[model samples]
Target: MKATPITLLVCALGGEGGGVLTEWLVEAARLAGFPAQATSIPGVAQRTGATTYYIELFPVLQSQLCGRQPVFSLSPVPGALDALVSSELLETARQIGNGMTSPERTRVLTSSARLLTTQERMQMSDGRRDPAELLKLVRAFSREHQVFDMNAVARECGTVVSAVLLGAIAGSGLFPIERRFYEEAVRGGVPHEKANASAQASLRGFAKAFEIVSQRQTQADFVSQVLKAQAMDSRLRGNDAGADGNDGRATALSVIPAEAGIHGFPPPVREFASLGYVRLADYQGRSYADLYTRRLRQVLDAETAADPQAANGHAITRETARWLALWMAFDDIVRVADLKSRASRHDRVLREVKAGEDDLVKVFDHFKPGVPEFAALLPSSLAQKLVAWDRRRIAAGKEPWAMPLKIGTHTAAGMLALRTLAAMKALRPRGSRFAFEQKMIERWLDGVVQGTKRGWALGHEVAHCGRLIKGYGATNERGKDNLLHVLDHLAVLPETEAATHAIAEARAAALADDAGQALDATLVRHGAPKREPKPQPIRFMRRPVPRESMDERRA
Candidate 1:
C-alpha cells in the first residue's frame, strides 16, 4: 500500500521569506529520512502580488528501502491542500477564494495584520475594505485557523518571520516530526546566521501558535472572557458615563491635551473630537472650532433624548463627535498650502525620499488654479473679478493658469506663502467655499437629528452618512449629492416604518462605488429619477474641427 504525502502551501509578502520557510520544512522532512520536495512561485510585493511556497513530504522508510515513490504537485491544487500558512490575513483569504482551502481538509495559520491595499489608500474617500469582513470569511472557510501577530513575534525573536512560520508548522502536530527537526533545519540547513538565535525564533513561534490552538479547545468561553476583560480595562481607563457623568453608558475615550482648544465637551468626548478641532482650527481658526461645537451640541441634544441608554451612558454622543469635527473641517486650497509648508512635512519628504542629512532634496508641487482656488483667497468683490477673468480664459480656449512651486519650506519666501494661507484660516468662513461646505454640513446634521428622533438604527445610518462627505472639490460635491439623495429620496419614510433598512442600504451603496453608480441604482429602485452627471468645464484642446471637409463646408 502507498502512503499519502503531506502537502502545505504557504503565502507571504516578498520580504517575509516564504521561500526560506518552505526550505526549512523540506529540510525538516529530509532530516527525518523522509523524501520531501519544495517549490515556490514568487511575485511582486504588497497587494500587487504574493509569493506562495508548496511542500510535499512522502513516507520515510518506504521511500528509502521499498522502492515506492510519490508524485507531488509543483503548485497547489484547490481543495487538495492539507495546510495553508499565510503571513497576511487578506492573503489567507485570497487563497481560500481561489479554492485552495476546504472546510473539510485545510488548516489555516495566518497573521491578523493588514498592510492597506492601493485601493484602500485612495485620497477621495474611505476606500478601505472592512477588516472585520475579511476576518469573518477567514473563520467561515478554514476547517481550523489560528491567527496572531506573527510579525511582532519575529521582531522580538531577533529573526525573520520565516523562522516563526517553520515553528508554527512544527508545533501544529500536523506531522509526527519532533520540535528538533525544525531546530536542526534552522541551525544546520540555513547558512549565514548564528544557529542558536535562528533556532530560538523558530521555537518561540512554534510554541506560541501551539499554545493558541490548545486554548481554542475552550475557544468560545475563552473569547468571551477576553472580550469582557478588555471592556473592563477600557472602562477603568476611559470610563463611559451618562451626560450627568453618573451612569456608565460608555467606556473611557481617548483624550486630547487641554491646550488644543478641544473644549466645550467633557474630556471623554473632547479627546475624540480634538483631531477635527485641530484640523478645522488649522484650516480656519478658533471661531470655526466654535461653529463645530455648536453643531456637535445639536447632535448631543438629540442623542441625549433619543438614546435609550443615554440617561446612563454617552456612546451615541461620543460616536457622533468625531464626525461633526471632520465635516466642519472641510478641505480647501488654504489647507493644502498649510500642510505642504509644515516642517514635519518637509522632514517626512526627506525621510521618504531617503535623502541623507547633508543631501539636498528639491520638491515641486504642481498646482492648477481655476476660479475656485484663486477666488477663495480673494475678498468677495475681488473674487468675482478673478472668476470673471477665469471665465474669459476658458471662453478663449485657454487652459487655467498653473504654478509649479519648488518647496521652499526652509526659506523665508516659501514659508511665507504657506503661512499666509494658514493665516487665511481666519477668513475661511467669509469665503464662498467655506459657506457652501458649512451649509451642506448644517443640512446633513438636521437629517441626523430627525433620524435620532425616529430610532437608534436610523440615527446610526444617518451618522454613517458622514462617510460620504469627504475630500475636496468634485469628490466632496459628489459625496454631498449622494448624501442628499438618501436624505431626500430614500429616507423620507413614514414615522411608523423602519427607515433604517433603506438608509443603511443607501449609505453602503454610496461607499461601494467612487462614481456613485451604486448609489444612483439604490435611489432609482426607491423611485428616484436617473441622475445626470454634471457636465465638465470645457478644456483648451478641440477636435481639430475635422479638417473642414470642403464639400460639406460648401454645402
Candidate 2:
C-alpha cells in the first residue's frame, strides 16, 4: 500500500490570521522537501463559525517519493485527523461535535480564550456556553491536547495569534518537518523594511508557545508554568506586581478592596455585593454605592427572616446584588463619553492594535443620538412632549430626528467634548430616565422582598427576573416590561411549586426570544393576560406604475 498522508485541520475566526498560518505550514512543508497540499472552507462570518483549513502531508520526504505523487484529500474525514488546531475554545468543541476528532489519533491544540457567538449574545440572560463543558469535550475526544491562552501569548509578544498557533503545532511534533523550517517560513511570509522586527515578534510568540507545549504534560501545569514565567519575566523587566502594588491575586473575596463597608452580609451575598458596591461606586459615587448596599441589606433581611436556617444560602439576595447594581448603573450618553475618554481605555486600544509606545494612534468614536436619547435627560413634562413630537414625525412617515457625531477621541478637541459630556453625570439624577428607572427598580425590589416573605423559591425566581432588565433603549425598555409583567402576574400568585415554576418558565421564555412572542405564549398558558401590543404606524405607500403600463393607458 502507498504511504498515507498525515491530515491536519486548523480552525480560526476571521482576522485572527488563519490564512497566514495555513500558508506558513504549507511553506514549511515545502521547505522541508515534503509534498503538501492544503484547502480551506470559509465560514459565514466572525464568531458565527470558524474558517477551517485542511492539509495533507506525505509523511515521507518528496526526495524519497521516486516521482510518485501521493494523493491528498481536500477535506478532513471524521475520525481520521492526525491533528486539529483551533484558536477558540467553542470552535474546538464544534469540531469534536462534528466527529472529526478521535481518541486514538487526533492531537488537539486549542486556545482557552472564547469570542462569544451570535447565539450566545442573543439571549437576554447569561447566554454563555460553559467553558468547562467545552474543555471536557476537548479532553474526552483527543489522544492528547495542549490548551492555553494563545491570544494572551500573542499580546505579550506583540504578534498575531497565528504565530503562536504555528509554534504550538511545531512543538506538538505532529509534523515530520524540523523547527527551523517553521521559523524560516514565518520569516519568509513577511515583507522587508520591518522584516527583522516582525520576525522577532513572531519568533517570540512562537518560542513562548513552543516552550509551553513542549515542557508541560497537562493543561493546568502548562498554564501554571506560563503564569509563573510571566511573573518572573515581568519582575526582570521591573514591571512586577510589587511595582504596581497589586499581586494580581483574587484567591478570596474578603481580600477584594470592594469589601469595604460590606461586612454584615452572608458569604454568598457578600461576594456579589462587594463586586456590586465597587461597580456602583465607579458608575456614580460612594453614596450611590451605599444606596445599593442598603437595598441589598433589606432583601437579605427578608430572605433571612423567611429562611432562618440559611438553607438556600441567601440565593435571592445574591442574585439581587448583581442585577440591582447593573440596573442602577443604567447607560447614558455620559457613561459612554466617560468610557470613551478614559486613559485606561486609550491604553487598551493601543495595546490591542500592538502599537509601540512611540506609535501615533488615532481613535475615533461614532455616535448617533436620536431624540429619545436627548429626551431621556430632559424633565418629565418636556421629555414627554419631545418624545411625542418624535413619535408624531415617525407616524407621519418622516425619520425621527437624530444628530450623527464623529469624534476623534485622540485629539484635544474630541477629548474636551467627551470630558465635558462626562461631567454632566451631576445632572443625571434630575433626568426623566433616571426617575423612571428608579421607580421600576423599586417595584422589582418590592416584589423580591414580598416574594421572599411568601416563599424562598418564589423569591429566587423573582430575583432572577432582574436579568430581564438589561441592554439599552428599546431592548432595555422591553426587558423592563417583561420583568414588570412577571412581577404583576406571577409574583402575586399564591406561593406554590407550580407558581414558582411558571415564573421560571416566563423568565426563560422572555430570555429565549427578543420579540416576546414566546413570553406571551407562556403568560397565556399560565392563565395570565398576554402583553398588550403597542400601536404600530400603518403607512400605505403609493406604488408607481411602470412606464410601459402608463404608456399603454395613455394609448
Candidate 3:
C-alpha cells in the first residue's frame, strides 16, 4: 500500500452531474474498503464557472491500516493532483491555468467538445477560441492526457455525460479501485422507480467510454514502439532525422482525402474545393456543385498563372472555394425548413430531451417570417415591388406583414408543411435573392481573379472579404453591403501592396464592428469614401398628456 492518498479533482458544468459523479467515486472507494473523502466548491449560475469536486482516497485499504485512520485533505494542493478530469475543453484549460496541474504528476482526461463561453458568443464574428490551443496547453501541462468527444458518446448511449466520465476515469487506471466497484456504485446510485432502464443506459455509456479509452492507450503504446524501432534503425544507419522527420511523417498522414467533382483541380485547391462541391451538392444538386467546381477552377487557373512557382500554395483559390460554397448555400426560409425537417434533427432533439424508447415525446417548432423572407422567393420584378411596399408601410408607421406559425412537428400536418417548404429547393434558382446572390458572387469571383493576376497578397485579401457575407436578414444584408463597399473602393485595378494591406485592414474592421462603422473608418483612413448610409424616413409621434394635468388645465 502507498503511504499517501490519491488526490483527484473534477471540473464539470451545471446539469452535467458533477455532484453525482463525485458521490459515485466516493461510494466506490468506500465499497473497495478504502477511506475516502470529498469536498465541492460550487460555481455561480450560468457559465460564470464550473462546479469543482476534490477527492482524496487512502491508497491503503482499511484492513491493512491495522486500526490506524489515514488523514485526507479537504481540497487539492496545486501540483499534487494525481488525476484531473473535465467535461469541457475550455474548462480543462482554465483549471490548468490556475496551477492545479503539473507536467510531472497530473494525468488529464478531458472532452474535446465545446460549450461556447459568453465572451465567445458575444463576438460579432466567429469568436471561438481555437481548440488546438487549448489541447496544446493540456499536453504541455499534464504528464499524460486523453481527449475525446464525451458529449457525442453520452448522446449515443442515451445517458448523461457523468456516466461516460466515470467510465473514462475507471479505464484511465489512475486509481486502485476496480471497474466492478464503479459499476456497483453506478447501479446503487440510480432511483428504484426507473432503475432498470436508467442503469442499462448508464452502464452502456460507461462501457463504451471504457472501451474507447483503453483502445486509445493501447494504440499510443504501439505507436511509441514503432517510432522507437524506426529511430533505432535510422541511428544504426548514421541518419539522425529527429523531430523534422517525425513532423514530415505526421504531415503526410494529415493529407486531405480527395473530394468528388474536383478531380480536375490541383491537389491543394482540390482539398477545399472538394468539400465545397459536396456541400453545394447537398444544398442544391449535382449541377449546382458542378457550377461551384467550374467557378473554383477559374480562380485556380488565374492563381496558377500568377504564381507559377506555387509560393502561396494556391491559397486564394482555396479561400474562394470555402467562402463561395458557404455564400451559395445562404440561409433562407427554405434552407431553414430543410434543416428543421431532417430526421437527424428530430433524433437530436429526442436525445437532448433524453426520451426513452417507450416514452412518447412531441416536438414543436415556431417560426415568424416577415415580409422580406417571403419576398426572397419571388421573381426579381415582383420581389422588388413587394419589398418596396413593405418599406413604405414601415415608413408610414404601420407594422410590416408577418406570418407567425406554431408547428407541432410530431403531427402529420406540421411535418407535411415543413417538408413541402423544404421541397421548394427547385424554385431557389429562379428566385430574386438567388439571382442577386449569384450576381454578387460573380462580381466577387471577378475581383479575386483580377486581384490575383495583379498580386498574390491582394487576391488573398480580396478572397478573405467573403467572411463578411454571413447570417440572414439584416445581418446578412449588412455583410453583403460591407463586402461590396470594400470591393468597389479598395479593389483597385493593378493592385498595389498598399491596397492589399488596406483590403486586409478593411476586412478586419468589417468583422470587428457589425454596424460597419469601423469598416467605414478603415476605408476613409485608406483614402476612400465611407460607405453611404441608406436614408430612413422620419415619423412624428404625439406624446400622451397625463389625465391629472389635463384636468388641472381644464379647471
lDDT of 3 by residue, 1-555 (tens): 578889999999999999999998999999899999999999896477999999998888889888999788888898999999999999999999999999999999999999999989988778999999999999999999999999999988989999999999998877799988998888895543556877888888999999988888888889989988988998888886764555435444557767778887777777778788888999999999999988988998889888999888888988898899999999899999999999999988887888877989998899999988888899999999999999989889877889999999998999999999999989999899899999999999999998888888888999998888988887888888888888888888344798899999998888888877888889989889998888876778889999999999999
The TM-score obtained by model 2 is: 0.83
TM-score of 1: 0.64
Tens digit of per-residue lDDT, candidate 1, span 1-555: 237878888888877777777777877787777787888887776577798888887755544657867787788789988889888888888888999988888888888877777867873456667778888887888888788877767655555677767766775666667766767776775552555654655666656655664466357457778878867876887855343455633576754666455466665567666766676666666777767777778877787778745553555556677777777766677777878888889876765554644777767665555577867756677888887888777777787665544555666776787788677776776787666667788888888888888876677678778878777777777888888877886667785254677777777877777777887787777666656777556665545656568568988
Q: How accurate is candidate 3 locally (lDDT)?
A: 0.89
Question: What local lDDT does model 3 show for residue 72?
Answer: 81
Candidate 2 per-residue lDDT, tens place, 1-555, comes to 237888999999999999999999999999999999999999999978789999999888888889999888888999999999999999999999999999998999999999998778776678899999999999899988889999999998999999999999998877898998998898895543446877888889999998898776566567778889988998888874667776767667455334786888887777789888888888888999999989999999999999999998789999999899989999999899999999999988988888876889999999999987898788999999999999999999887799999999989999999999999888888889889989999999999998888889888999988999888888988998898889888777764677799999999999888988999999999889999898887777889999999999999
> Which of the two candidates, 2 or 3, achieves a greater TM-score against the reference?
3
TM-score of each: 0.64, 0.83, 0.92
What residue runs in model 2 are displaced by over 4 Å at the alpha carbon?
1-6, 30-39, 42-49, 56-75, 176-178, 189-194, 218-258, 351-361, 381-385, 388-399, 537-555
**Candidate 3 ranges with C-alpha deviation above 4 Å:** 189-195, 218-252, 493-495, 537-555
Instruction: Rank the candidate models, highest TM-score first.
Output: 3, 2, 1
- What CA root-mean-square deviation does each model show from the true structure? 9.5, 8.4, 3.5
Q: Assess each prediction's global lDDT (C-alpha) against the native.
A: 0.73, 0.89, 0.89
Ranking by lDDT: 2, 3, 1
